[model samples]
Target chain A: MIEIHDLHYRVGAAPILSDISLSLPEGSLTALIGPNGAGKSTLLRLMARLEPLQSGRITVEGLDLATTPTDAMARTLAIMGQQNSVASRLRVRELVGFGRWPHHQGRPRAADREAVEAAIDAFGLQPFAGRFLDELSGGQVQRAFLAMTFAQDTAWMLLDEPLNNLDVAHARALMARLAQLVQDTGRSVVAVVHEVNYAAAWADHVVAMKHGRIVAQGAAEAVLTEDLLSDLYDTPVEVSRHDGRPLVLHHHSHSRIADLSRGRLPDRARLS
Target chain B: MRFAAGLGLAALLALMLVSLGVGAAEISVRQARSDAWTMLVLMESRLPRTLAVALAGAALAVSGTLIQSLVRNRFVGPDTTGTSESAALGLLAVTILAPASPIWVKMVAASFAAMAGTALFIVVIRRLPRREVMLVPIAGLVLSGVLGSIVTWIAWQADLLQYVGVWMSGEFSGVTAGRYELLWVAGLAAGLAWVGADRFAILSLGDGVATGLGLSTASVMRFGLVVVAVVSALVVTTVGMVPFLGLVVPNIVARVMGDNLRASLPVVAASGAGLLLACDIIGRLLIAPYEMPVSVILGVLGALIFLVLLYRRPAHA
Candidate 1:
């Protein structure tokens, strides 16, 4: 379980996060959904302790982030940011091997090597194991990073926009793998997801943010209503059920254009 | 990799022997006449100078690799951080304050001043918004300018300008058994670098990942700064400013072998020694007794290579 209390983050004069307090249930695959500039990434980064906390307290399990040692925190929680570029040109396997660094520090034992190989196999990266990161496609790179995060073998995984540039099929595959991890391994996950449908399909819980605060958070079904999403994005939307999950309908601007064609009618007629 | 390293070492050994023979002394290479004069020249001048060149080259190259990795910048080196200039200032202060001080005092002062300069550079870098990778080296160059000018102005006023540019324009002509001993300390810094190679590689990945991986990014960066300062200061104190030796050597090594320091650091050291020794040879042979500074040749060659590196940046880069 991860708990954040009275978290207020300010960047210069602008308030990035304002007294945002929330508790993420343990072993739940949670989705963080918000419009642009809603501070979704900031909240994730703050929880991960990637950014220093200004006025807040975060705890993973029973350990407080403020007082816990970095190595201790690393053992329990692993976070991956959107753009994790390696200045060193490393192969996929080598990059994944670094995930065991916290465990072995540098010297890899037989177990560590096994974990690295398992991570590669887990991500279906065996074919590209020897390929440099630059040689992989964007989706492949994202999967490679995911493999590294998995290789950490922590209780919780915190990801900020892991599906950022991945295509629909790749994104689905990643979410499915994440779902599998949560179900089979009981690893808690908190991801900043852009495509609301993916969140609705995979996330057991959803936290909606707006204007630097949690607008709503609960079981995925309870919080992902049409009214909530429409208000969250400030755009008209519809939510309909698909395969027993909420499917967000956001492509409505064309309907307005069609309504304009509702035949008041002959002001501009085509050749037809 | 082992084969390449062995080849490099063998070539280096052959070159060391040739360098020993090519000096101003008329020592015969013939095995029959190993007389006192020949022994004296080899021990007192040729051997020490050659060893000093090797030490300085390896130290500076390791220093360059450390800085570039820590900063995550391809263009960064010890010079970019004003480390050498600050060290030069330290040496200048010692020269003026106590002209009779031993070489150890001067070396200590230079390294201390260099560490201070690097600390200030870190503070400045932290305060500024990090929008560009190029900004770091530019900031370092500017800081070097300011620090270097202070040394110049003071040296000029005191009429002790003779000591101002000791190692900046590198030459092996002045190296002898006693004068170049500080370079061994620089060699120690290189060994420390080798031992800490994994820490550097992890830190090079970036702050967030490094932190996430439980490594203290700040301390690792501090370690890198100290290594850079110590190596550059030692080299500068012993040999003067060897411009671009650090920048050019480490980069060429990284191009041939990737930045996994554990695997590549020894190679980097060898490449650095080979390149510097080669440059020194060219400088010596070009004018013979007249002697051009090795720095001059490296400055020209490094600039050309740098341009090529910039234009031919990897497609993924």
Candidate 2:
């Protein structure tokens, strides 16, 4: 279990995350979703300890976040952020190999090397393993970074905006991988996702955040409703059943023609 | 990698031998007529000059690699960070305060000042938004400019401008066996840098990544900076100022290699030594007997390469 209680993070005078509390279950695929500026990434970074907790308590698998040794913490959790601008000259395999640093420090054993190879294969990156990161396309680079995170082989994985630069096909492939990771290895996963459909399709749990606070969190069907999403984004949203899963759809509001016939543009059509 | 390193080593040896032969006293079989005289010249000046040039080049280049990694900016090095400038200022102060102080005292003072200068750069960088990535290095260059003016003013006020000029214009003519021994410490610092290469490499990935990997970034950053300070202080005290040695050599090596410090450190050291050796040889030949300092030669060459690197592509933040 990962527990966060009364967590608050501030930058200068502005609060980035406030009064957050949650218990994340083990072996679950948890999706964090929110509109822009909802503090989703900040929340992810805090849980990963990438951002310091200003005031609160967080425990991962009975280890206090405040006092756990970094190396020990690393053995339990691995995180990949959106901005992974490491030197592009590094080979794809070498970049993936860095995931083993926490375990090996500097010296690698046979098991470590094999783990790296397995990760490379898991992402189907074998063909480009020898290629430098700069030579890969944006989506390929994203996959390579994901492979590195997986190579850590931690029980818990935190990813912030991992789907950026990935096309629909790649996104589905990654979601499938994440689902498989949860089901096969029983590793707990929390991912910040922009597209709610991806979350609706694959996530067992959904965490909705807004204005630095958690609005709701539960099973995907319970939290991802038409009323909630419309209010969450300040735009009308429609949710319908698709293969027994919620599929969200919204396009410029259903009142567009009525407003247009009234001799005025729809509210959402304003250029300003 | 082995072949390139071997080739570089071979080139360095060849340069050292040729450099050992270029001076006024022709060290040859003819000079064997007086073995004592030839041996004395070789021991007293020639060998130390070659060794000092090699050590300084290697030290400064490794220092450059560490500084660039420490600041997480490719453009930053001793020249831009005010490290060399502060070192010069410390040397100037000692020269003014104790005109007759021994070389060790001056070195101590310069090391202190250089560390202080780098600390300032770190503080400034800590406050930077980091989104405006180029601004960090530009700020470092600005800091260097400020420190340079202070050094100039102090030199001008004390009527010791010539002494300051000699310190700023690096050369090997004055290096003797005992005078350049501090670089041995600088050399050891470079070796330590290589030994701790992975720490620095991960640090270059940025604090978030390093901390996420469960590494204590603060201590590693401090250690890297200590290496940078020692290298800058020792080299400045021993050889005046060798501009762009840290910036250009490490960059060229990293371009061929990657920025993985473990893999790139020794190569950076070798490339730096080779480049400085080449520059020193050119200085000796450019106006034979008149003998230009390597700094003057490297200034023009380093500037040209730095400009090319700058115009080639946008640097990562």
Candidate 3:
């Protein structure tokens, strides 16, 4: 379990994340959902130790984040942020091989090479392993980065917006892969997802934030109700059941005139 | 791989011999072997100059590769980091303070100052808001230019401008057997960097990734910066400022061979030696009795090549 208490972050004079306290259970897939400027990325960064803790304490599996050695933490948790921007000249395989650096330092043993190859195979990236990152398309590059993170082989994988720049098929594939990893290996996964439907479909737990504070967090079905969805986004939304999951509908307005024209309103709406 | 490296080694040895053989005195290979005095002269004068060129060439190129890899920026180099300029300033200060100071003393002072300057550049970069890598080099270039102007002004005021000019012009004319020993420090530094090449490559992947991989990014960066400063300062003390040698050689090598530091390092070293040796030969032949500074020739060539590279789409970041 990862526990955060009274986590606060400020940049200059403005606060980014404030008084955030939460416990992430192990062996679960959690999705962080929020509006723009909701501090979702900041929270994720803090959890991953990308940013130092300002006022609170974070512990991963009973080990203190601030006091534990970085290598030890690395072995336990892996994080992939939104911005990649890796040197494009590096080949896909070489980039993935870096995941084994903690284990092998500089010299790669047989196990390291085997792990890298398995990661490549797992991501279905064997065909493009030798190719440079620049040569790959956006979605392909995303998969390569994901492969690199997976090759890290940590118990906890914290991904900040991993689905950005992926096409619909690629996005679904990535989600499916994450789901499979959680189910098969019992690995803990936390992803900051922008699309509600993705979280609705795959997330076991959903945490909602607004204005740098957690507003709601629980099981996906509990926190994803119509009232919470409309309040979270400040827009009216209709929730319907599909495949025993919530399908959010927020696209069109439910105007009385449209309803009357469609002959789906009462006599009062038709007369008006 | 061994064969290719061996060929490079052979080419480097041949260039070294050719460089030592041709000079203003025109000592023939046969004549030098026949007389003891001539042999001593050849060994004492030409050999040192050849070694200086080869060592300084390799040092600058290796340092350049380290700096570029550490910052993950192609345009970065020792000169751009203000290291050479700082060394020049340190040498000038020694000349003005103790006009009769030993060359070794001056070199030590310069190395210390150069290291300090590189440390300053790294600290400034670390304090920034973390933008693109290109900004780091640009900032370093501006800092170097500022430091260089200060050194020039001070040299002029001290009336030691002539001494400073000779040292700043990047020439191998002053090299002799005993005086060129300072360059051995550069050679040692290059060796140290080669041994740590893997750590440097890992650090180049950005601090977060390196930290995630259990490497101390700050420690690795400090080591890299020290290597760059030491090699650059020692070379500046021995042969003056050679422009673009560090920047152009590593970049060209990376383009041709790829960014695998283990593979590209030796190539960068060889290419650096070849470039400097060829430039030095041309510098000797163009003026014959009166030698043009190798720095001027290299600066012009390096600038042209750098511009060409800028126009071509970069294959990697």
Question: How much native contact recovery, as a fraction, does model 3 achieve?
Answer: 0.43
The lDDT ranking, best first, is: 2, 1, 3
lDDT string, candidate 2, B1-317, tens digits: 68977887898888888878778666772464579888788888888988999899999999999998888778877878999999999888898889799888988899889989998999998899876678888999899999989999988998988877887889998987788888888999999999889888777777777877788998998898888888888888888888988888877877777777788898898888888988998998899878989999999999999888878743442
Candidate 1 residue A51 C-alpha distance from true site, Å: 1.9
- Write candidate 1's Cα lDDT for A30-128 as tens digits: 999999899999999998889998997999998999899999888898888876455576678888988988898779899999999999998899999
The better candidate by DockQ, 2 or 3, is 2
Worst 10 residues of 3 chain A by lDDT: A263-272
Docking quality class, candidate 1: medium
Could you tell me how far off, in angstroms, the CA of residue A245 lies in candidate 3 after the best superposition?
A: 3.5
Model 2, runs deviating above 4 Å? A253-272, B29-34, B98-102, B129-131, B314-317
TM-score of candidate 3 relative to the true fold: 0.91
Ranking by TM-score: 2, 1, 3
Q: Which candidate is the best by lDDT?
A: 2
| TM per prediction | 0.93, 0.93, 0.91
Supply DockQ values for each candidate.
0.54, 0.47, 0.45
lDDT of 2 by residue, A58-79 (tens): 9999989889999899889999
Candidate 1 lDDT, B105-194, residue by residue in tens: 998999999999888877777666655656777888898889888888998999877778655567778998998998898999888989
List all candidate RMSDs to the true structure: 3.9, 3.7, 3.8
Poorly placed runs, candidate 1 (over 4 Å): A254-272, B29-33, B126-131
